[model samples]
Target: MSDLVDQLVAGALDRVTAWPDGALARSSPPPRSVLPGSFNPLHDGHLNLARVAEEMTGATVAFEISVTNVDKPPLAVGDVRTRLAQFAGRARVELTRAPTFVEKSRLLPGVTFVVGADTAERLVAARYYGDEARMIAALRDMADRGCRFLVAVRADGAGRVRSLADVAIPQGFARLFTPIPESRFRTDASSSAIRAGRRAAP
Candidate 1:
């Protein structure tokens, strides 16, 4: 990792260690809630989610940019630095490359994990891991440790969103925010779109 990226991650780790439940030794204190993503280039949706999460929970939001996407190639360390700069001190957002879901879970034991509808569907679909129940169980365990999840709704091609009512939120979520319908910000820029440099990804 580049020095700057390392600094950002270290700074984020410091903050995480300072939360009410943050005890570095035990790895038990639920750090501030985390919104982990690749963020090839931070976008408005991310900013919106951070703002909305703070509005809904009144807690600092941690923007975790993990380097562990099996589907996509990893981003350069400098890219991580640039993105961190983009989010510095915005509603208690912290940027870091988590590298693994387990690492992320361990780092933010008592915080909420933000994701989208597609990830949520995979969390329960046996086809993805052949043990949907195991995935659910793990997430529940994290919640039991004071960690939970906040799943946001992503827009479809027609500017529609999957309602929160459509998904089953397992027990133990620290807090749950309603899915933001497509009517609020009908964005078309996604991370993929940003990477492709075609139109823009929402």
Candidate 2:
């Protein structure tokens, strides 16, 4: 991690210092919540999500990178640093390496854990955590600690956002924000698209 992002994550970690697990003093208290994403190349859409998340919760955003996902393929360790550079000084955010969504979910008690609609849907997949019940229970535990959820609408092929109203958010998971129609930014860029060495950007 870049020294800058390390500082940022440290700052964000300070917010939950009171948790029994202890806090990193260097971290800042995230004003709103975190909008966790792979942030591969950190595209405009991700930036828009951060802005919208701030508007909704009145807090700074943090970008989370999953380490477990990185080992699966072409993404290098330096990718986080590269993506972090894209947002430097533009926002009071930092990059973190979270091995699992559940582990990251515990980082900031009471903060909103932002995710894409597809990810929100996958939270209940049977393969997650080897059982669906444990996943649900874990989310509930996070909620009990003040952690909430925010989901962005998934963009359809036409670049239109699908409705998130019917998405099944587990009980106690409060919706802190939704993607504004105006905040939509379309891109064909994704990790899969980028791995092909094409014009992929996420």
Candidate 3:
């Protein structure tokens, strides 16, 4: 790894710094809304989602990528560079070690998280947090931090379109989410499909 990448990785591990090309100066204001993703290979779907989110919230959307993940291995130095490159001249990005939204909320308080229906579903799943009670607690913490989610509609594996309404959000925490109507945006483009060579890059 180059000296800059090494420094960035260390910063993410130590202080949860936001790296937009270079370190985000301490004077920079925290982002208002962020679309956290693996990006794998950013496509038009991701771009359109950010654009619609910006219009809906009237906030400039920033992209976030966690160097470490719960389900996947930590990104190598080269992998991190490749993902960050996709955003060059396109959008602002923050590199982090926060693998979950709850952690991300702590790092970026009072931010709206832009996510798809599939991610919203996983966010509420009890399996991820060990039990329903713990899951509720996590949501409560995120809410307390003034974190909210702007969810977009996405197609399921069975080809059915799912919206925020389709997610089984905990009763009291339902207010944390707002749906982006299908009328406003929809896309079949997915990074996984593209990576698998099943679809062309958008």
| TM-score against native, each model | 0.67, 0.67, 0.89
Candidate 3 Cα misplacement greater than 4 A, ranges: 1-4, 8-27, 198-202
| Tens digit of per-residue lDDT, candidate 3, span 139-165 | 999999999999999997788999998
Give lDDT per model, in order.
0.56, 0.56, 0.84
- Top of the candidates by lDDT: 3
Tens digits of lDDT, candidate 1, 1-202: 4344444444434222221232122132354667777675778887787777776668867666654355766555566556556655453333334554545665566667766765565555555545767766655655566655666776555766654556666564325334545444334567777678755545
Candidate 1 weakest lDDT stretch, 10 residues: 17-26
Candidate 3 local Cα displacement, residue 94, angstroms? 1.0
Alpha carbon lDDT at 134, candidate 2: 84
Q: Decide which is better by lDDT, 1 or 3.
A: 3
Candidate 2 lDDT over residue span 11-30, tens digit each = 43312211112222335554
